[model samples]
Target: MPINLFKKSHSRQGAERSLYLAYYFRTPTPTNPVRYHTALVVLPSPSPIPLAAAAATCAEPQSDESESLPAPTQSSPTRARSPGRATSPLPYVTTATKFHAFNVPVNENGRGRVTWEFRVERDDPGAPNTPLRLRLVCLLFIGPLSQNVGDHKLEKILKKTNVEAKYMDEFPKYYCTNWMYEALQLLVDEKIIDPLPCSPPDFWEVGGQYADRWMAENHLQVPYDLPIPCCDRAGVALATPMGPVEEKCPDDETNGNALPN
Candidate 1:
């Protein structure tokens, strides 16, 4: 009985260890994003329109005043141009839902941040291009964390999001990496930003919140027409600066897929 009593105290003396086990086994701390979303969309088209909703098939018309408003047009100037000239372009044909809001983050940095790729088309969470975009963004933004985008954890995220693994290396080659990465490389190459230690000139020691903020504040000056520029062999912008990132590859001048790799 006395030996048994000693054994019990031996377990009780380990109470600190028990508590430690409990704490170690406790649920993981929830991660909170450093940035908050603001100003959802750029209003490529005006939203919250006053048009009357019509049901499928036959529907009754609204009141006389309801039908009096002019139809939505893109060419309608959002701002002033000349004395009588129009300022805005013709209305774009958008496939976006009217009720939804586009999410643009106030800042882009946080503790252990993750990038999820998106397409202008597939607004939903699932798509083949998202992981490629995510990995590409992570790499271009910070030179690839925890190995390549094809890593196991990345594969899991891609699988969880219903993305395909086949597209791991497939990107627009221009923006094949996505917009943020392109912006990073562009700003860096332009000498608009300083470099990060052990990282590319495009990467920042403080992450992208600073650049995102800078862009957000000054994006009005950016030429929407110049989303991506094609480079010539001398690393200069060609006459036409649109299309795939690899399109500017020196070899692309002759071969298509090799892209000067």
Candidate 2:
């Protein structure tokens, strides 16, 4: 992390910086399945640099045909709708860290259920002395704040984290009301992410002019929001055909979609 980044004009970069900071980290290394969607939550785009800050920071280089391709993106149950840029406050991690949370859709089989992926990265990588630490923080303040704003857009359990903090509470005690807006504020102050128009039908649109800066600097795609934007809505609402009640399928034995043993 560059010391000069703390300058007021560079604050917006903090949000973006939070994300890219992860690539440089090697957390304690988890024993869990390492849920896949957690992987897609992009940290700010950052150029892949060698271990040392002193090394020349090269932009992400093009890959050769010989190398194995990157893994596919996975989904996570924990997520939040990104409100536009920095209208609200987002938390800033001044130390090395990765945080993550699991979010289940509101309804297990219900139609309106939504599951989102969220994360945050740190600006620093601590040396062994501190061993990098994590804390469980929450909002005792939201209820009052919600009353004033009259906006209850937040889904149940609105905790925020990066990949590393995903399990910190388990080892000690954990739960948090940390939200993305706090992260956005850091960017706004830094000038990395400028607020943008809320997408149609969205009460708030969240985007940044420089959101892509980290990715550009790092030579990678900009991080996407949960329920990532997809142009193809074809199958999302397609209804499943119904089968005759109490009737055997003509090819039940051969059909794979049919209920299994």
Candidate 3:
């Protein structure tokens, strides 16, 4: 996972702060397809730490270069301990992974797309032993064709990689080819990620409702019949501004719009 920290300041009205995690997903397509999925696990309003205290932490003296720094034995009153060895005074500390599959147009004029995202949140930095909260958010778009092209693509990929064969006996009961289920299994194989529950809460149904509320609150016009889920409340503040359909192409590498880190 990539980590970035930044703060935006205004001369007239103090500093405006924001923190986020951007997870990129790719799929097979004519052009390189990159999707950015973000989730906000914690937001401490009114600022959690005083400016002076933050500056002090940053200016703390360090041990000699030859010596190794000891791990934190106790949580700080002003800071939160994220999963792993990192600690942050800011409110946002979360990580995520995303996967996407593009539906190739067989006989139709348009194509469909599906994305699966897994987010883990360390809600209580104070208690490092507590279980981390996990959630899955799935977004689907159907084109002119009524067939489930996204699911077909996902199945083909899983079969090709032999991932489906290994998990055939324990395939999910709901949807065998579910992209989320397969992706989670892959992550579990890699020991880097651990302690994941058998099932994480799914928020696909409420995605659209949250998107609508976000657009309305931002005074943006909702599309008449668009099927894509726009903004998730978890990361609504960090969402990119919506533009006209013709002006936006997520798969276009030459668009010059870099994905936020």
- Model 1 poorest 10 in a row by lDDT: 16-25
TM-score of each predicted structure versus truth: 0.18, 0.19, 0.24
Superposition-based RMSD of candidate 3 using all C-alpha atoms, in angstroms: 20.1
lDDT of 2 by residue, 36-153 (tens): 1111122221221111121122212222344322221223232332222211222222233343343333544454443333533332221111211111100000001112211122
Candidate 2 residues lying further than 4 Å off, grouped into runs, are: 1-179, 182-207, 221-261
Please report, as a residue range, the 10-residue window in candidate 3 with the lowest summed lDDT. Answer: 1-10
Residue 240 in candidate 3, Cα distance off native in Å: 11
- Model 3 pairs in collision: none
* Model 2 clashes, total count: 38
* Candidate 1 C-alpha lDDT tens digits along 1-261: 000000000000101000000000011123322131111011121111111122111112223442232211233223331211112121222121111112222333553322333322212111112211111111011111222222233223322222222132332121212333333344335443333232321222122222232233332111221121111111111111111121122221121121101
Best candidate per lDDT, number? 3
Model 2 Cα shift for residue 153 (angstroms): 23
**Using lDDT as the measure, what is the rank order of every candidate, best first?**
3, 2, 1
Residue 153, model 2: lDDT of: 21
